[model samples]
Target: MNFSEHFLHFIWKFRLYKTLDLFCVAGEQLRILNPGISNTDAGPDFNQAKLSIGGTYWIGDVEIHLKSSDWLVHGHQQDPAYDAVILHVVHEHDQPIYRKDGSQIPVLVLKNLYPEHLLDHYHQLVNSIHKFPCEKQIGEIEAVVVNGFLSRMMVERLEQKSALVLDKLSRLTGDWESAFYCFMAKSFGFKVNEIPFELLASALPLQVLRKHLDHPLQVEALVFGQAGFLSGSFKDEYPRKLKKEYAFLKKKYGLKPIGVGAWRFLRMRPQNFPTLRLAQFSALVLKSDRLFSKILEIEELSDLIKLLAELPVNPYWIKHYHFQKETKEVKLQLGISSVHHLIINAICLFLFSYGKYADQPQLISRAIKFLELIPPENNTIIGWYKSSGLIVESAFFSQAVLQLNKYYCAQKKCLNCGIGIKILNK
Candidate 1:
């Protein structure tokens, strides 16, 4: 692998790429003053640096290189930033170089110092398993190292999602619950039906919903209306009644359906048809008063399971999918396992966000461990997501743990980050 390939390792190995170094280029001996921009997505890994060369210190912009010739190869010599570069640090030095203004830039070569083992480990990580790009055998990395790594990895994971979350939050008028509802429903739709589910959410409003707090029937109307499922002449007796109620409610509430259909049903397995699933979700909201707040207050996993079980759809739905398919009454029930999975996901997200407010992660851990006692749910729905490399295993009510070892953890970046001076000086 080339030195530029593992730039973070290079920076961390040597102190040359820091923002807190007082040093200058084109002089006898350079002193470091500052290090900047360690986590920026573009440009130099570092943004600002200070240093003195010999007895003369120049305070200006900073530039980095894997080798001296990279200056011209990377076309940095033509950039004005090179003019203020106080130090020129390289992993390997092949020749002298001058900036666009023709001022000679001083250089320090680092390839002779960075450790061999670190580079080897890097290749091992990048070249081994190709799925997640960097997830192979991270399972083998040491605990402390992997923990820190996963912590950062989790942050990165969340960071990638934050902008979308912020966007949803804005759309929901800054309501975290509404944003979360949209998010969960969309995720439940699992990529294929995501837009349909999001449309379902957008079509159904919370305020119009509160008008039918005591009647699951009105709630079903709003949900089915939002889903655009009312057009098919729901053939069963109960469906007829629901349809009548829906028409009345629609006119009264000024409700307009989103024109979505059974989203797709002919090819779906019996358990996952759009009608049954939406009914289940609608039942849940009808049964709970402010579902998220209740979820937040629930501390017991079993109780959480029962509370979910208690969220009844329509009593008549107990034995049917459509208001009346005359099928074997499967109880139209959510298994404890499904409830546990959702609860754990909600709990983890809550703790992840509000973790600073309480010392209850261990409690949450206990609750999650308790959830494992329940039997796992087997379904094509979960297996489909699993096949796609996303987390779908019931065990995920816990967390994704990647093990780390000396190859990654022992190196202290500032003392520990990949782009710190330690790797450069190693």
Candidate 2:
């Protein structure tokens, strides 16, 4: 049977093969006291293993391959890293292997010891054309197992998002406030104009905006101007005022705006237009005094929501979604759903990142607690997981499902998934 090295890894990791009695191809009895921890980096496949071969106890690393000759194929003979290897585990012992000192290495063959059904089930799941590898068998898993795995996946997702935040913080010389500002701007763009919003934030730093925060119009002018919307002629008086204000501010700050073409409005609702988002973002900047500090003090979900809620947008945006276009009058405040999105994507990510870097476990606990308080996001990808019999009632679960879908299901990494492991083990 043809199988991937990953499949072989699974067999070795779980000791899926029979273990009553084992022997090496060199005619010596073998007993595994411990298979050791699996290594993901360079060198050995498993590290710090303990074994008894021919009544001699040994403790070192174990290297695995499809065949014994693969040891030489991988060029391990001359490398010093492999010198500590105490055993060679192979599916087929086609040839002998030796250490750099020219001493023979003991080999164990596992071609027949493992159950064939396990391989069959693994192949069936990975080779399937379904949306998820174990979509069909997922229903059979107990809720406890499913929830446990999702809980893990949720934390993994948070860690992954936190990594981006931490990277930004590092680049800013550990400036948490600036990192939060950039990420918050990106979240305001809501995926469509994310890149442009990020660029706008970079061009106009938080310190520059902070100086003008006492004057709401100047704050709006800086954000709008840096976004590339303040340039060119406008038919409306509001934009003309902003254009004049921006011209002075741009020269004062020596700022260069991103290209106007970076913003996208195609297939987007008027309320969600980039212009409206920038307007709301400007209002948020003015209202959110020491925003990162305020976020750090927030304990309750309601307080966090209140902090991000119902900013008094400028009167100019009350009847307009663009610079020169007028539409029906609309309340220009963030919706509850949009606020929840900000909490999930920006607030939680920063909290988690800060907790990890600053060594505050309480902050991390609060970050996760905030997710539990929010409702699940309504998106097509989430709806599909709900249809698959998965409970996705909170952003916590929804984030987990998104992570599982993107990292495990989409990539067909069933062997590394808890759900897949449960299905295959059964």
Q: Which parts of model 1 are misplaced by more than 4 Å? A: 1-5, 8-43, 47-52, 55-61, 67-83, 91-102, 129-139, 155-166, 187-192, 251-254, 259-269, 315-319, 322-326, 346-398, 401-426
User: Where does candidate 2 have its weakest 10-residue lDDT segment?
Assistant: 1-10
lDDT of 2 by residue, 150-268 (tens): 99999999888888887898899988889999999999989899999999989989989989878888888888888888778998888888888999999998999999899999998
lDDT of 1 by residue, 1-426 (tens): 253434543444345343333233343665565544453454554556665667675666556667678778888766664566655666666788876667677775555444566666555544444333333333333445533444554444333444566677677777766766766566445445667877887777666776787887778877876788776676676677767888888888677787665376666555566677777788777777566666666666677778766656566655565545645566576756556556544444543433323555664454445435544344543333234333323343213221111223222122344322222233
Q: Where is model 2 more than 4 Å wrong at Cα? A: none
Q: Which candidate is the best by lDDT?
A: 2
Best by TM-score: 2
The number of residue pairs in model 2 that clash at the backbone is 0
RMSD of each: 6.8, 1.3
